[model samples]
Target: MKLAIVGGGSTYTPELIDGFARHRSALPLEELVLVDPDPRRLELVGGMARRMLAHAGHPVTLTTTSDVRAGVDGADAVLLQLRVGGQDARSADETWPHEAHCIGQETTGPGGLAKALRTVPVALSIADVVREHARPGAWIVDFTNPVGIVTRALLEAGHRAVGLCNVAIGFQRRFAAALGVPADDVLLGHVGLNHLTWERSAVVGGVDQLPGLLSERLGELAEEVELPAPLLAQLAAVPSYYLRYYYAHDEVLAEQLAAPTRADAVRAIERELLDLYADPRTVTKPEALERRGGAFYSEAAVELLVQMSSSAGSPLDSPAGRPRVVNLRNDGALPFLPDDHVVEVPAVFHDGRFVARDVEEVPVEAQGLVAAVAAYERLALEAAVHGGRERVLSAMRSHPLVLQHERAEKLTDLLLAENARFLPWAR
Candidate 1:
């Protein structure tokens, strides 16, 4: 099958290629096309992918191109993994609104708003490319950040898309490791939205394990917390940077403030990564992989085709004796929230079809938050697509944290002024 990876120049290209190569026997990738605007980076990643494929003894044809149209033409699956702007842009995103409001910019705070504004256009453009060139019924897997929002855009555009985040899988693996169980033996039920998702329930050895039992050993789970925010938050609900910001503001900020913020502190760790990539090493080199690790995150985006096309006409039965993913609307599946939001759950896939496991309602408090975020998400999209300042304001108002800050008006004013480049309606 022809598979195209957009943003092939990304630092994660090596890891993705490695993943594809590792799973080639199952997916049987025949042609791999790497697309990026930077020719130098494209050559670098392309060379690495080819090397990996060769090492795997997979006779997959490899192609590299700077043009999306050319690279994606007739592709079975197109992976969208581009960065709108790199770290420098993120630094700006983190610092801008915070500098304006005397509050530090955060992942989901005003900083997230600004970053999303900068990102949506590029995301839409990539979707447009797929619309023009992808094979009929091709799948578009988005590994972009602010995944909930990006996935919404693709769904709105009537594209077959699913957002893939590796955090859940990484945490699941960590949970198994912590329990001294095989990774495949863990069964997990995931809930919440985007990075906010929690492993609502987990089963080990066919026994249900409550998160409370696991949280008792806080020290042991620190590494897992460091994996990603949503998963980390689920595991460590009361403390830590990511969840604390959303829930326990005073405590989380204090922790961050106490930590070193100097550029040297940040760059010290980055220097090691840069050094690894700087080495003219082969793709299979450990040093190269270590450097590439941070950029890749342990997540992967496998087109349904790769899984379904290759499967032996059986439904993609949900893995048994372990937690698996099942996607469904939020209404009957989740008692607390409205019925229409798309949620992922543990399920079995057999043949090519999926059967999601039923889940109980989320707690009232949690459901309320999800509802608020969903409402805001809808309004944000409406404000962006149509023109409505009130819609945007209402959405922001609905966010409990925004109200808690009492800076909603100020944030709204600042966002309207700063985001004019993206939200022309605000003007």
Candidate 2:
């Protein structure tokens, strides 16, 4: 199959390629295209893929290009891994709002809004390419930040797209390990937007296993909470950050971590992980390029696709020939969402069609939280398009953080100042 990776010059390229290597036989990839604006990065990733394949005695026709049309033309699947501003751009998004509003947001909130504004146009531009060049029924896998907003835009623009993030999938493994069960034996189910999902239920040996254990570990988990969100949500296997207001307002997290603030607990965990990654013997370098002789590689979606297609474990019975997938457009893909929310969920592929499983709807409370943030997202998009400060302020008011209209206005003022570079078109 002809597979294309846009933004192939990403830092995570090697890891993604390695993931693909694990299922190389299943994929039997004949052509791999790496497309990026930056020549150096494109060569780096494309070269890496070539070398890895050569070493493994796989004769794959790997190509690199800056032309989006050339890269995506006739492709079976296109994996979008774009970062419009790169690290410097992301810094502007994060630091601008934090500096202006004194709110440290890396992902969601004002920081995310600034990022969405800069990124949405670029994402749309790529979508335009898909419309022009991609073969019929080609899948577009989006692995970008502000996933919900981006996927929503793609759907609205009448394109086929799915937002993807490994956080939930990774957490599933962690939770399973914590419960002393094999990951495969754990029947994990999650529902919600990216980075924000409620772990619905988990089963071990066909028996419910999470509730009893989580009830006991609640106190300890609260003491050293690494993931963001509220303790109650944590108990229910939900992203802790969903209850961000409680953490800041009710001091629920503080009381839960009476000995140390939740922030403090996070610091300790960060330090430990950093220390491990920083260890001299850890070889933190990207050795795949050196040992394998290339600059870039494939990613998780590619590797997983191969496995599912090959029936290595259990043949994906879905129509698309992929084992697990994340999709946005509701053609009965997800039954629970409002038919508009871009949800990430497990999917199966078969008969050249990606089929979304029956995903349960998020709880009413979580839906309200998602709606609150979604309202801000809508306002942000409107503000960006219209350049209206009042509209931006109104959008900020949609967030729970801006409890009052006055605070929301003040927050908008701060955002305007901080995001000036990004808001030349906005008023």
Candidate 3:
């Protein structure tokens, strides 16, 4: 199989390469292509990837190119992990929101909407190139930010696509460790849109262990997710760390006001990672990469590709005891949201397609927030595809975190001014 990674110059690429090398049996590849515009980064990251593949004795032919059309041609699957304006734009996304008293996060609130506006057109254009060149039935696995919005844009444009995020698998692995079992043995009731989700249950050996865990380790789990323990006990579900933007907005804003932006931290980490990648002796994935975040992304990406890109005659089944989490169309997965809305939930590959596993239950308390965010996501997507200042304001206004019209209006202006270089519409 030939697999291509768009934005392959990212410092995150080595982690993915390491996963592919380590899990060759699950999704063996004959060719691996790295597509990116930054020649310097492509060289550094590509060298590290080739070294890791060689160390694993994997015979995959690694190719790096700036030509999207040439790089993706004949590929079996394309993974999108690009950042449109890099961390500078992300820093702006994280910084401008505070002026309006909103949380400064790249994938939530006004900042998330800003990212969507800057990212969507580029992603769709890349998908167009992939559609024209990649093998028929090739899957586009989006690891892009504002994943639910980006994945929805791809699917709505009629691409065979699914959005992948590490949050669910991250929770699964953590829960498994807590339970003293293999990661594959833990299944989480992970549901909601990407970056806006809750862990309703963690099942092991056919039993839901969430109640016991919440009873015994509520504080630990709550601390990990950054929400209050009492809140977790009240909801009886663990919310993703992103939820801290909503459930505890004031505290997060206060911290953001005082602390350096996450984008700043990532920029420093990327520099360190590139330095390591440039070293000829650095044949192994470096430890510094761990602090770069996206924990467990490579495993999640590998498992998704194995199932989604399986040949018709040998479709892979869901892992032994774990359910995959993906961003897919709601399609009645949650009756309250439109069928076209994208959702992140536990899913299984079935009958030549990925199907979201039935949610035996959803946290009732989360419905209003989910539905509101779903509404904002739709407008956000529309603004992304068709540019207009009013449309941008509408999306900002719709977000749960920026509901007040005056604040939304102010944020829209800040977003456009900060991202003018990336957004043709804003320019």
Candidate 4:
């Protein structure tokens, strides 16, 4: 299969190369294309990717190009991992929201809104190219931030797309290690929108082990969620770490205020990674990339792609129906949310598409929060597609973190001002 990575210059690309090297038997990649606009980073990352593949004796042809159409042409699948404005823009996204006392995060609150506005247009443009030039019925695998909004945009635009996030896989690995099982044996009852999700149960051998995990491994679970153990016990669900920003907004904001922005830290790591990638002798992904975040991203991407490509007759098919957590249209997977809205839920790939598994009724405790965030995501999508200050402000106002009209108004202005260089519509 021919696979194209649209943002191949990213520091994270080497990790993906490593995954493909290790899982070559499953995917059997023939050609790998790395497409990016930045020639320098593209050359550096592409060089390292080729070396990593060779080191593992995976004989896939590696190529790089600055042209998106040329890179995606006739490819079997296209992966979207582009950051439209790079880390400098992300620095703004992580720093400016603090002025409004909201969480200074890249994927939630006003910051997420800012990223959506900047990213959706670029994502759509790439999708347009893929539609015109890619192999017929090729899938678009999105690994972008604000995935729920971006995936919603893609599905609404009539593209075959599925969003992937590492959070679910991260949880799965942690649970598997803690329970002495393989990662694939640990199934998560992961639900909600991307970045706004919770693990209600960890199932093994067709049985839910969450209750025992909570009771016996409370401290470790709490540390993973970054919240008090009592809080998790009270809810009876383990929330994704991002939820800490909502459940303890004030505390997270105070901590964010005291520390350098995550963007700053990542920028430093990227510099180190780029330096490493530039080394011709370096043939494997560096350990420092682990601290750079997006942990287990390659595994998540490869597993999803392999599942999608696996046919009913293939050995990869799940006889007992093992589901993978992904962001796709609700389609009644979440009854409370609109069918057209995107949700992160456990889904199985069947007949060349992902079908979201039916979920039990959302717990009463989590329903309100999920509903509220889904509503905000809807408004955010609208604002992202059709740019206007009013739509942006309305979306911000709908966010659980910036519910007050005054705060939303201030944040809207701040976001537009900070991101004007990246968002042409804002300018």
Candidate 5:
């Protein structure tokens, strides 16, 4: 199999290379192509990736290119990991939202809207290139930020795509470790739109162990979710860390104001990572890469690809039974949301697509938030594909974080002005 990574120059590339090396047997590769527009980053990251592959004794052919069509040609699958306008744009996204007293997060709130507007167009154009050049029936595995929105745009454009996020798997690993079980044995009742999800139960051997785990390890679970233990007990569900911005908005905004933005921290980390990659002796993925975030990303991405590829023989086959959390169109998985809405839920690979596992109805407590966020996401996608100040403002107003009309209008202006360079339509 030939796999192409569209944003192969990212600092995250080496970690992915390490994953492919470790799991080479499960998903054998004839060729691995790294595609990026930045030649300098491609050289540094591609050099490290080759070294890592060699160190692991995995002799898969490695190649690099700036041309999307050339890299994707004949490829069985293409992975989208590119960040439009890079981390500098992200830095601005994270910093500017504070002016409206909103959470300055890259995947939610006003900042996420800016990112979606910038990313969706680029992702669509690349998808077109892949459609024109990749092997027939090839899948587009998107690891891009604002996964829900990007995945929605891809699917809406009639492309074969699925979004991948590391949050659910990260929680699975942590829960598995605490329970002394394999990560695959840990089943999470993870549901909602990407970045806006909650784990209602953690099952082991067909038995829900979340209640006991919560009772015995309340402090530990609270610390992991970054919420108060009492709150966890009260809610009887574990929200993703991103939920902290919504549940404790004022407190989080205050903290964000005091600390340096995450983008600033990432920039510093990327510089150090590049320096390490430049060292000839540094072949293995450095431990420092952990601070760069996206923990368990490589594992999640590899598992999804392997599952999808293994089912190629029967394009419409149902899953073999094990469920994995994925971001794809709802198709009634949530019941409450529209079928076309992109949601992150526990699903299994069947035939050549993802079939969302039957879920117990969403809890009453989560219904309103889930529906509201899904609505906002739809509006966001519309604005992203067909740019207009009013559409942008409407999407902003629909978000739970920016619900007021006046605030949404103000944020719309700020977003348009700050992200002008990336949002060509807005400019």
Candidate 6:
């Protein structure tokens, strides 16, 4: 099999290389392509990847290219992990939202909208290229921010694609470690959109251990997710750390105001990781990448790619694969959502495609929030595809965070101004 990584220059690529080296049997490969526009970072990351693969004795042929068409040609699967504007743009996304007294996050509110507008266009363009040049029945696995909006763009555009995020896998790994069980043995009642989600149940060995974890591991769990202990107990569900931007808006805003932006921190981390990658002696994923966030992302990608590789027409396309969390079409999984709406939930491979598991246990209080934010996502995608100041403002105004007219107006102007240089259409 041939696999292509679109953003092969990223510091996170080595982690993925490590996963592939360790799980070659799951998704055996004949060739690996790293496609990126920038030549310098691409070579640096590629060098690290080559050394890592050789050290593990994984004989996959690896190539790096700046040409997207050439890199993905005849590839069985394409992984979209590109950042349209790089970290400088992300720093803008995380910084400008604070001008409107909004939580400065790259994937939740105004920042997420800004990212979606920039990312959706590029994501669609890449998917189109994959459709035209990649192998027949190839799959595009999106690891981009604002995953719901990006995945929706791909699916709506009639591409064979699915979205992957690490949050659910991180939860499963965390719960399994806490309960002294294998990660695969842990089942989650995880539901909602990409970053917007809550874990209502963590079942290990067919027993719900969420209640026990919340009660017995209150401080530990609450501290990890950055939510207050009382809230977790009251809701009886564990909301992902992203939910802090909603549940404790004021508190998180204060912290953002005082602390340095996450983008700045990540940039520093990337610099260190790249420096390490440039070293020929460093042949493995670095320790510092752990602090760079997106935990367990490599593992999640491996599992998703394995499933996609085994789907219809592929050599391994037989036997239903194990269930895994994915961002896919709702199709009544959430009854309250439109069939075309994208949701993050456990999905099983069946009949040559992934089928979302029914979600019947979302916390009652979270239903309204999910529906409300989902509405904003619709408008956000609209603004992303068809650019207009009014459309952007409409999406911003509809968001639960920047709902007020004045705040939305300010945020819209700030977002456009901050991102104008990097915006796909503006260029």
Give the per-residue lDDT digits (tens) of candidate 2, residues 306-364.
Answer: 63344424445433333353645455444444566566666655444445664556666
Cα-based lDDT at residue 272, candidate 5: 98
Clashes of each: 22, 24, 0, 0, 5, 0
Q: Write the per-residue lDDT of candidate 4 for residues 32-63, one digit (tens) a residue.
A: 99999999999899999999999999999999
TM-score of model number 2: 0.76
Clashing pairs in 6: none
Which sections of candidate 6 miss by over 4 Å?
311-320, 424-427
Question: Candidate 4: misplaced stretches above 4 Å?
Answer: 312-321, 358-360
| CA RMSD of all predictions | 4.4, 6.6, 1.5, 1.5, 1.5, 2.0
Error of 6 at 194 (Å): 0.8
Window of ten residues with lowest summed lDDT in model 1: 235-244
Evaluate model 3: give its TM-score.
Answer: 0.97
Q: The CA-based lDDT of model 2 is what?
A: 0.61
Please provide, for model 6 over 176-265, each residue's C-alpha lDDT reduced to its tens digit, 9 standing for 90 to 100.
Answer: 999999998887899998889999888876689999998899889899988888988998888999998999999989998999888899
lDDT of 4 at 188: 89
> How does model 4 fare in lDDT?
0.90
Question: Which stretches in model 3 have alpha-carbon errors above 4 Å?
Answer: 311-322
Clashing pairs in 4: none
- How close is every model to the real structure, measured as TM-score? 0.81, 0.76, 0.97, 0.97, 0.98, 0.97
- The all-Cα superposition gives candidate 2 an RMSD in Å to the true structure of 6.6
For candidate 5, the per-residue lDDT at 290 reads: 96
| Per-residue C-alpha lDDT of model 5 across residues 1-427, encoded as one tens digit per residue | 9999999999999989989999999889889999999999999999999999999999899999999999999999999997998888898888888888898889899999999999999999999999999998889999998999999999999999999999999989988998999998888989888998888899998898888888989999899878889988987878899889888899999999999989899999999999999998998999999999999999998898888877645443344447789998999898889999999998878867788985555667879998998899999999999999999999999999999888888899999998888777766
* Cand. 6 TM to true fold: 0.97
